[model samples]
Target: MTFDLIIALATACVAFVLSKRSVAHFPLWRAVVTPLASIIGSGFLLLGPILNIGYGGYAPLIMIALCFVAFLFGGVIRFNMAAGEQAIQNGDYGALAIRIETLSSWALAFAYIISVSYYLNLLGAFALSLTPFNSDLDAKLLTTGVFFIIVFVGWSRGFKSLEKMEYVSVSLKLAIIAGLLIGLMAHFGHRALDDALIFNPPKLDGWSALTLAFGLLITVQGFETSRYLGSEYDAQTRIKSMRLAQWLSTAIYLVYILLISYVFRPDQMSSSETGIINMMQIVAPILPFLLVAAALASQFSAAVADTSGSGGLFAQLSRNRITERQAYLLLAVIGVALTWSANIYAIVNYASRGFAIYYGLQAALGAVIAARQNTGWQRVGFYGLLATLGAVIALFGQPVE
Candidate 1:
């Protein structure tokens, strides 16, 4: 594990340097890689168990279909970004876009706070679970304290330093997850073959699958972050990046689901908040500790990234009504409060709804863009109805676990 950590850090450092250089020199790299990195994280732990337990052997199929749905949503966001950029270019910064932006920013902030809170709870739980502190309250308190400290550091120093840490955290996270998949392949190769042939599992109702997907919506939401990068990149680049991000993330997630589904018994997996740890423990005792470390790194990186995003959006939407630092701190405080009020699963549900609402706004923006570009009336109606349906699902969908 120690050697693996060193290797992951070294790889991340190199990758970070290359990525920064690419951002400076190559627009394509800037477009492809930046969005790609931002789109994946520890949210998979929550997503995977829920998906597998709900859909059994059919989780991969559901995930594939969901990924395509996410891709369509990504297109909506991309079109919206293009429209916004065009609006700025035409010197028409329209009222509708501004209203949507303001509302989306608030929703995005709410979602990020909830996400941070849930991750803090997860990290605290993983840490304590390794020891004797068995109370959920104790974990929440410890997580709150840790979260506050992270917020203070981020607010004081800003994301410049945090961005540097992201390379390491992201690399460690991907490497650990990949390692787990590889480890599973090695340990259960013959068993996996037999399991594939058997493929016996409980029936998965369509409504249950849809509800589970809605509940886990936040896991696939990182592609939308590219919409916020409009100020940094041109609309074309941002749109392309969003498209690339959705593709890359879809492939990665599909591979992970395939490996884990074949490797682990569906009945053995449960809807535990520490589902990753539970999955890893069944494979090897040491695997949980490594996954815990990876989870901590991923969650910290995610919190810092979202903090920076929410702060920037708040500042932009407010037209400098509040300073970025103040916005960040306020978000952190909200996160801390939320951590005390809900456990990880409840937070997941909140974050799913939060992001779902934000996506609906983006879809509305897509409709506006379609009208402006004089695109087909079909696209206009498609995005319009998608926005309505997304909002409805988010508002009323039941969570199975």
Candidate 2:
């Protein structure tokens, strides 16, 4: 009960602090919030258990590796933001850079399609987790309903009204995540003092483990959202905010994975979609409630963001041949199909592959720009390697079993 009270108090304090005008109104913070929110979305709810169950005590290490890979990808995007944009504006790279950029945008639009399904499906699962209607079919039906709502709202009213929910949702989700970390920390300390911490062996090894990590790329996929905030921020601001968002999210993820890895036995981790909620039931009674709240806010907001993004990208890339309304309808149809055809884990894999293809194209574009600009063989080689890696991940990444 003491721990529960502490967790509740911590959450309230963080929420209150985040709601203050100084923090809420800061320009850099506001810019940071978008990508940060997206980056930490449904992944926070799912990755802990997946990593803990799959990698055991080495989960934190795996988390670090995931973040590092994401940071490298982020570096590619950042370069494109700084240099590629200028080159395109000046017509310095001929049509090759322009072509790759177009292909990447199209890839991103498709990736967003998969990712919206990923977010809303998790939202449905978490929404029904504590209720009596807690089955796969129930979750799928709920997800389908939400898809329709998004489509209706988007087509009828536009997402401007719903997009405002992002700020509040980001604050609430971050505050709840703070509380979860505090609870996990206290639990971890207690276990350490009692010598009850467990360091289980990895359940996976070698090539299988490598491919699984590839599939999980979407867990760290949202940093690219920062690259698209051009209308709201300058190139420099976007680059700085993106770097900050990735760093902060990486820190949060590493701590969460580290704390959870040692505190729970392999058997104690739930294998279901809402497994984290059940696992948190042991950490503190308040934790499950807080987690569910965070899950709902983060997932819904992320879905809306991606849906809006997909619509805009499709409309732009198609030269308005596909209106944003038609794109929303297309997304709704595909999202529903995904919800019915695949489980959340499989959707996660598909989303990861989709994003990987987008990142690869971005990397390929970066390499072309670098080569044309005489940016040195080493930099060009790095980008080429990243492009190959992204392609490999897209081709070989497998779903979690």
Candidate 3:
């Protein structure tokens, strides 16, 4: 544990230095892709294991289903991206756009609250694991303080600052994930063939499977971060980057699930939120610290990015009546409240539902915009279909075990 703290603290110092250094301007890809740090953070570590915990050999099916819905969600965001750019460019957010933006902003803000809670819980778990003296309360308090500070600083400094640091955070996370995959493959060696063919029967019926798919929607929530990039980036770049992020995430998730599912029996992976840590611990003791550090870094980066996005949305929707700082302050307070009042899994449920609600609004707005632009019935029908799907998930998607 002492060694773990040393590694974590060293990692933190390196991150701090990276943040302080001058960063070059982002290219089109970098500009649009960096925000994905918010989406792909600790999620890469947790979501696959969570799916395995429930679906076992059937987890890949759920992953494919999730990828489909995520692409649909991406379509919803892409369709609406034009309207947002137009709103920014003309400084005339139409009545319908404003209404949609308002709804989406509020829903995303609530989702940010849940996300903050979940991030803090992950941080607390790490803190407790590393130190015998730290209680959950102590961990929460420490995390809450750090979270508020990051949100406030990021809001005051603006997206440009966040974008600058994003490359480091995103790279670190991706590297950690890649290293884990390599480590697992090396450890498995010839056992890979034996494990690859292992299968368990389906545990969920169709309705339950659908419910689980919707419930796991939070795993792809960050792709829509591109939706708000209009103020800083070109429309084409935003759309392209968003699609790239979605496809990239889908591929990464598929590989991650396959690798993890082979490592454990279906029943062996239960409902623990920290399944990644446990899995790593079983293979090699030193491995857990690396995963823990990655989780901490990823969660911190994600929380800051989302908090910044929510603050930007609130400031824009309010026409600057609420400054970004004030919006961030409000969000931080809400996040702190949610962190204290809710467990991590409950927060995950709320986060999933909140993003699902936002996706529904985006889909609805996409349909409306498609109608206005006379983009043809084909486009309209596609957007409408997505809207119906989002609405179904928003209204009836319950938390799945």
What C-alpha lDDT do the candidate models reach, one value each? 0.70, 0.89, 0.71
Off by over 4 Å in 2: 84-86
The candidate, 2 or 3, that scores higher on TM-score is: 2
* TM-score attained by model 1: 0.87
* lDDT tens digits, residue span 163-258, model 1: 666655665666666666555555567665565433436455867657767777767777776666666677777788788778877877888777
* Tens-place lDDT digits, model 3, residues 234-326: 888888888888777777777777766656766456566666777777655666777877777677777767876877877877788987788
**Pairs of colliding residues, candidate 2:** none
Worst 10 residues of 2 by lDDT: 84-93
> Compared with the true structure, what per-residue lDDT tens digits does model 2 show for residues 1-401?
88888988998999999999999988899888878877898778899998988898899999999999899999999998988475674678778888889889999999999999999999999998899999989999999999998899899887575566778888899999999999999999999999999998988999889999999999998888877777778999999999999999999999899999998887789767789987899988889989989988899878877887888889888999999899999999999999999999999999999999999998998898889889999999999999999999999998889
Ten-residue region with minimum lDDT total, candidate 1: 195-204
Off by over 4 Å in 1: 1-38, 86-94, 193-200, 203-206
| Rank by lDDT (best first) | 2, 3, 1
lDDT measured at residue 135 in model 3 versus the true structure, 0 to 100: 69
What's the candidate order when arranged by decreasing TM-score? 2, 1, 3
Scored against the true structure, residue 182 in model 1 reaches a CA lDDT of 58
After best superposition, candidate 2 residue 293: deviation in angstroms? 0.8
